[model samples]
Target: MHIRQSIIDTSSLEGQRISQLRAAVEKRERGTILASKYHTAPLKIAKAFPMGDALGVIVMDVSPGLLSGDRYELQWKIGHEAHLFLTNQSFTKVHPAPDSMGGSAIRQSFELGRNAIVESMPQPVMLYRDAVLESETVVRLEAGAVWMGAEVLCPGRTLRGERFAYRSYKNRLNVYDGEELIYAQRQVIVPEQQLLSAPGCLAELTHTGVFYAFSDRIKACHAECVRSTLEAIPNRSGHPIQWGVSLTYKHGLAVMAAGTAAWLIQEALAAVWRMLREEMLGLSPISF
Candidate 1:
């Protein structure tokens, strides 16, 4: 069953609807998909696409756009030996909330079996003026399982001259092995009360990308390569994009890129993913 839908009042935008999507893959081999199911509304999780041993899935938002008080849920289950990549169809634009109190929230879950691999590589989140969002992600991993995901957060609508105009954005990510929490992350961005461009903050960078990989197969060379590859991506601009990669406290690698433009950040992220896929996962780079 789909997760319990969050109670939200969307009366301001009459006829507005909430979005729920749940999809899972038991296994996939050759070109055959197995034991899969999906239920969707404004969001969709399509069938897996096979490439060598890896399977790719496209995620999309069918809504006109994210409206105020819209709640969304997406879950994916990967069984043993299953290799899945989840990519976004386009940027997710967070529109201004009508009922500021409820706002909009999204929750995503990933459940993986032993030796399984699942990747969540979505496009950037574009925050419009007065957009307020809360997002949560929970990952359940068995021994030897691997999970990777990347996210880009945009402060506001650049073309419209909305700079750090969002009301707030909060995110919490949790990873677990068995019943123990292995890693946790929390980010709260409130532009109204905080100076996002202040020293040690966003530092005049309007966009940022963060990529994470968690696995029991972490290697020293892989981490170093990931870091260097990100740093080496050339920026035609005189002021290069600020980026770095480091080994997380857990058995994973964390990469971050900050820039004034979303395109620059996205480019760096894709390059890093390409390198990691080839060197660490033994798969060819995926261009999408």
Candidate 2:
């Protein structure tokens, strides 16, 4: 049996940021807040709130988690000058359905307003054997807005000899400003069919992750500054990670693709985020 649910909420304040939440359960839609749920919603586990942020929580034990032919979507919109951070208390593990005669799929999307900021980083995603997962995140930002995000993935678990264990996992992210595409990335992984074990692929690396920051208001030498920071660090091969920092019209973007253990990626992201917060944006660190 397949099950799903959907939840949506919208909030606006005269001087505060607008809040919106959308979640699904049992393949149905329910009007629920990020902290509350209706019938069939995922079980609420632990939620945390830090200073200068909006929402933080974890919903787990999702009934029927995700089965073949299942689809899930979540969307949020932040008003001007508002800030929000969302995180999953734990890593999301994808397991093969009992009767997975076919394959499973998932999709996630986000939209933001001008001058709005969001930071969402949890643990890495684990893909089990014979599972197929497809996730897409789309962000629409206004001119002069900012966005920072990170993602981690394991090709199954190396300790378990689960090499290329999954059928496939593809994730795509796109950022736009008023129909103008600013940044776009597409990643597709197939253990059984791809060059995951090749020197260029995961290159015998167990886990990999990427972190990026994009902002148009950054200074003229913003891209160069970011590149210098990456050059200062090292990569999985004892060299600097494959770093790419560039400047576009009204925007500066930096992407780091590192081959290392999951924990290392997390710590590196924390450091990079801190540097950007203090030096680039002059904003205090807002933990989720």
Candidate 3:
């Protein structure tokens, strides 16, 4: 795969840094390949490696982290029967945003052709004191398409005693099958405005993780399997971790976990991912 450089005309928006990445993957007789890719500064794909039958691509950022007024736009197009696993290099560090600009924003969209599959698993996000972030993701899946995504959120620099020091964090996700909207979720966390340690809120948990699997192949049996697997998972870290699994209204399942450590949440989500990959794709556990 060749990385194409594109120039963005940022003459209008008052010197705010805007980065963009557009990529497409297709399936051929050999295997899934990166058909085309274009990226601007602060976002690039060095190469696409093979992960068994699927293609793995890691999104890289040249900048230290997201600063005030920074915007990232990512779009992915997956051809029929293609499988792509997308991840990032490291944690998404969000620095404090100016009160005027509000916060940094991330906009991502995915278009999956028939029988296509995409797994988007990025690393955890770290919010600094007074940091603000707003993220939105939209996915459009055609017949027989499958989309899996997971996210881990960290309050702040916990070791620096900056937990819950951020100003606000907001995220919205929408998934559509053809013209029908199947899933919609909006989450907002304002540490300074709300009582995050309350019973109804995050309480004692400092980190949160969410995993979502959506496909037309999802069935009642799959939901049961996920539930049983989650129940059977042991807490070897001795950390208080809480999790739950739920089936969507149709053709989907969600796993949510909250814990004191990021690794605890990651381990729980990895277990669910392995189970789903075996039951749905008939594939072995992913190596990375």
lDDT of each: 0.78, 0.58, 0.86
Ranking by TM-score: 3, 1, 2
Q: Least accurate stretch of 10 residues (summed lDDT) in model 2?
A: 1-10
lDDT score, candidate 3: 0.86
Candidate 2 structure quality by residue, lDDT tens digits, 154-250: 6676688776688878888777776688777898876667776678665746677777676666665665665566566555454333434555444
Model 2 TM-score relative to the real fold: 0.75
Off by over 4 Å in 3: 1-15
Task: Give one digit per residue, the lDDT tens place, for model 1 in 1-288.
Answer: 222233223345344355666666655446325466665677876445776666778877877667777878677777777788888788888888865355777878888888888878888999899888888888878888888889998888788899998888999888887567888999898887998788797776778889888888878788889878876777566445788778877677888888888888889888888888788778778787
lDDT of 2 at 54: 39
Residue pairs with backbone overlap in model 1: none
Off by over 4 Å in 1: 1-17, 28-34, 99-101
| Candidate of highest TM-score | 3
Cα lDDT tens digits, model 3, 1-288, are 222122223354467678989999999887899988999999999668988668999999889899988989888989999999999999999999878875888888888899999988888999999999988888888899999999999989999999999999999988888879999999999887899899987788889999999999888788788778877878665678888888898788988889998878888888888888899988887746
